[model samples]
Target chain A: MPQLDPTSFSPQLFWLAIAFILLYLLMSRLVLPRVGKVLGQREERIQGNLEKAVKLKAEAEEVLAAYQKSIADARAEAHSALNQAAAEIAAATAAREADFARKLAEQTAVAESRIKVSKTQALADIRTVAGDLAAAMTSKLTGVTVNGSDAGGAVEAVLKERA
Target chain B: MAAEHHSPLEQFRVEHIGGNLSLGGYDISFNNSALWMLIAVAAITVFMLVGIRKQAVVPGRWQALVEFLYDFVANMLKENVGNEGRKYFPWVFSIFMFVLFCNLFGLLPNSFTVTSHIIVTFALALMVFIIVTAIGFIRHGLHFLSFFVPKGAPAWLLPLMIPIEIISYFIRPMSLSVRLFANMVAGHVMLVVLGSFVLPLGLAGAYISGIVPVAAITAIIGLEFLIACLQAYVFTILTCIYLNDAVHMNH
Candidate 1:
């Protein structure tokens, strides 16, 4: 076989050494660092992206929590305001009703006093009429006359006895 | 129809190229073998350099291929030789790429296989042997000598076992080189002999004999392609294993 030729061995070895050393130097010096850098940068970028995503997610959750808390607070405030308005309306209505009742009682007391005075005046006029009727009838039948003041005393005696 | 009946072995011939100029009285002439070696080196360089020109974060196809090969070699060393093997990446990666590209390129028609020669394979194996032994000695001092002495043998059998161990250790390079050379030679010889039969037989008669060789060459070419990849892998892994032995010295 031509491969067994001793003369060809040296050239093959020489070339092999050159090719191999050239490849080794190229890989070690230029190619290895570039490739390693690309791979390393890629890893770092992916890691950074993932961390950013996590941070954004946490921020989003925090905002959601705050939003929900504000909603609950606003609802509570509205509820309390509603209750306070209802209580104020109830107090105003009660005070208005109490004032109307006190005014009605005072008007009722004034009407009662006027009604008593009218009743006393009506009794005195009746007593005068009765005393004149008695004096007229006695004068016509037996020629006798009586005063209103005496008649009023006699009527008051009769009203007291009846009461 | 008559045609040249070429010798199947004629394909292995080494011819001088460009009127070979020697230097310092050594016949280091430029030949077909040297030309192919340069092509292999060029191919490797382009595959690496141009493949990463973009160096995109999301890699293109060529960049992915480059990274894949890099990771493959890196992982091979990591598994076989551990972290201590990191320093030897350049040598290991270079040899792996060299042998792989040479073997693959040889499969092309009219291409010279660089690894098919015993001299080339022997030189590579010898280098690996020397480097591994040097590492062994440097790491363990005289304890590397104890590598050839078995631990569990009886006192009487120690003499026989030690010599056997020494012989085995020395045979590593021979075995490594011969295995690669013989495999390449055998596969190529088979393909050439079968290939020679195809065109002539097809034109000679109405018989289907040519089809048989065609089918066979097809199958064998596929097998040879697989062998090309396998041999390169085997060579690299073996280098890693030997390096492992030197670094860790379990036996």
Candidate 2:
């Protein structure tokens, strides 16, 4: 066995250091930074996707609310139209009944001949009262004209003849 | 007989590469140190490639192990170096793997301890030193010199403090290299010496003495294996510290 020499300076250390430094530089400059860039880019993309999802969710919610509101408006409009049709039907039926009653009363007067004047007076009063009530309701409900002169004069003439 | 008993450490020597170049009386050779270094790199490459080639969402056993190591190093860098430090994780990770591979390879039967040599450890330490120093200068320029002169010291103590700081700054590579080399060399030497005792006992016709030496060698070998890993850890952690100084230029 050769005697160990402690004082000897090993030159291999110098070359090894050089090689290591070169390798370290390669790793630091080339490899590491590229990986880091990829990771950072991935994180940014994920955040951007999350933001898009949130925006999309908000937009979907807004669309949903708008759709619900329009549906409610359509329901209300349908209900009002149905009520107006029913009211018109009732008014038409009542007008038809009034005409029928008037004709029947005229026929009764013709058949009897004794109370013809009283029956005509009573029929005129009933028609005048109905006109006045309709005009008042129209004026109150729709802010429209409700004239009383013609109805009042007829009603008063009928009452005087009866007296 | 005494001379016939040769130490196993004699295997490590500097030899000329291609047996030709002799520049300024220095033989530039690919020695045991270089051989082990190449082996370390090859081992790491094989391990990583083989372990990660078939990456599954539900990973196999080997893939799981590789992912665990990757996450361990990544998390360590994130915790110690911060988010910005994550940028340098690959380099740090490479250093760790290379050192760990070399250390583990050295522990095999009849294998050379590359890290036990001062040259290899010094090379690694010098790299950490140079990179950190360069980063400091690049980041701060002339102002980075102020790192040696710590803040909060009295102006009257500037002269004394400056030299102390400079000495300590210069000692970074020395401490880094010495810590790893000394630990590796000492641990391996102890194991070898203990193992040799078993041979001597057997030759002396003392079977009882052989038992103690054999048990001691076994225990020492186990301890040396642990030391191998520990030295690598120490080297990597020191590298991180040095890098922190560069990135922050705080010291």
Clash count, one per candidate? 0, 0
**CA lDDT scores, all candidates in order:** 0.89, 0.71
lDDT of 1 by residue, B1-251 (tens): 13333666676778898776676877888999889988988888888889888979999999999999989999999999999999999889999999999899889999999989999999999999999999999999998998887888899998899999999999999999998888888999999999888888988866676898999999999999999999999999999999998999876
Sorted into a CAPRI-style docking class, model 2 comes out as incorrect
Worst 10 residues of 2 chain B by lDDT: B11-20
True contacts kept of each: 0.78, 0.20
Query: For candidate 2, lDDT tens digit of each residue in A1-163?
Result: 1112332224456555544555556445654444444445556878899999999999999999999999999999999999999999999999999999999999987877757777888787776776697668778998988678764665567667988
| Candidate 1: stretches off by over 4 Å | A61-163, B1-5, B20-25, B150-157
Q: After superposition, how far is residue A124 of candidate 1 from its true place, in Å?
A: 29
